[model samples]
Target chain A: GAGVSQTPSNKVTEKGKYVELRCDPISGHTALYWYRQSLGQGPEFLIYFQGTGAADDSGLPNDRFFAVRPEGSVSTLKIQRTERGDSAVYLCASSYTSTGELFFGEGSRLTVL
Target chain B: AQSVTQLDSHVSVSEGTPVLLRCNYSSSYSPSLFWYVQHPNKGLQLLLKYTSAATLVKGINGFEAEFKKSETSFHLTKPSAHMSDAAEYFCVVSLPSGTYKYIFGTGTRLKVLA
Candidate 1:
């Protein structure tokens, strides 16, 4: 079975630019999640989607961060006016259900210079 | 108010020796505890989970963790340390027993000496 997959393994952009990270969850997974990991730190929760709707967005740091999973199979994490502080490895995970065990992607490393 | 704490920042053990990674947690409700491992330049992988169903849980690669409610701990242990086990390990907690939200610990870096 194919596991979760992310796009653009590495990205480098200016501080004021915009970036969108994409994730493709495993087939039949109904719950998707986004997380960010800073260097030398554990992954921090960003948002979660149950089906096509977001189940939890409280972990999003600010309004500049947004995510969507319209069809429930693929998701994208959008960042506006990216700051140097936003540089980190963005991770995506999916589960069969909200409470099911998570399967993770390799991650998209974003660098805001 | 759910949180997980990994007592050690780093641990080192000789190959074929015992391995132990300590973790403590705080939560308002009964929590779901998990251990995840991350190799260099790779994403996190689930090592095992404890959902109160079993105090001792076995996971892939001969890894296991024991949940102790009295000490608020879920420490991971293995009888023999392998070089492949050298990686960053994270302890995570979910509140209300079965929730999607997770609170991750600081993590422990395990090094295997041959």
Candidate 2:
């Protein structure tokens, strides 16, 4: 696609199981971000990567949530021992520069049962 | 520390009527502000942005916002509300610059009635 792409549009898993969500950003984008959005709430910043390096991860809720962008193009959000509260839409966005406009993907909706 | 606050959790307006969504921010320095709209099951799209330039910033879809330094406010407004305008709006604040960190408000759900 011409824009950011996310895999597994919807995923449902049992509680305590681990899940991994993938995101493919636009070509040549150096900045990528991850956010989690619950019902009736705005997206909360989780992590940000600047060319394969996590510049800031202050928004990550806890150690249970982690994200990696090895090549700086595709990033994956990993959640361990997923709890019911982990259910939400995981959004990914990218930009050519750190301060440029952002382009977001449709987001991967994860449901922890 | 910096943060953005959305005044209304939800705003309802009649078709063709004027619409307003209030947003406020707290920053130690002059921060960059933005308003983004998210339709049902869609990604957020930027409506407008204020980067210490013009106070009144015009954006797509006939939406605009004013950046007030003294009041520390950035409110989104539209002259006429359309039914299709019903969506969730988010106010974001990015401090300093050269970073992807953004503080997002709780968001405001706009309901346009016909």
- By DockQ, the best candidate is 1
Tens-digit per-residue lDDT, B1-114, candidate 1: 778899999999999999999999987789999999999888789999999897999999999999999899999999999999999999999887888987788899999999
In DockQ, how does model 2 score against the reference complex? Answer: 0.75
On the 0 to 100 scale, the lDDT of residue A4 in model 1 is 93
Each candidate: what lDDT? Answer: 0.94, 0.92
> Distance (Å) between predicted and true CA of A79, model 1?
0.4
Off by over 4 Å in 2: none
lDDT of 1 at A66: 96
Model 1 per-residue lDDT tens digits across residues A6-84: 9989999999999999999999999999999998888999999999999889999999999999998899999999999
- In the range B15-104, model 2's lDDT, one tens digit per residue, is 999999999999898899999999998888989888888899999999999999999999999999999999999999988743567878
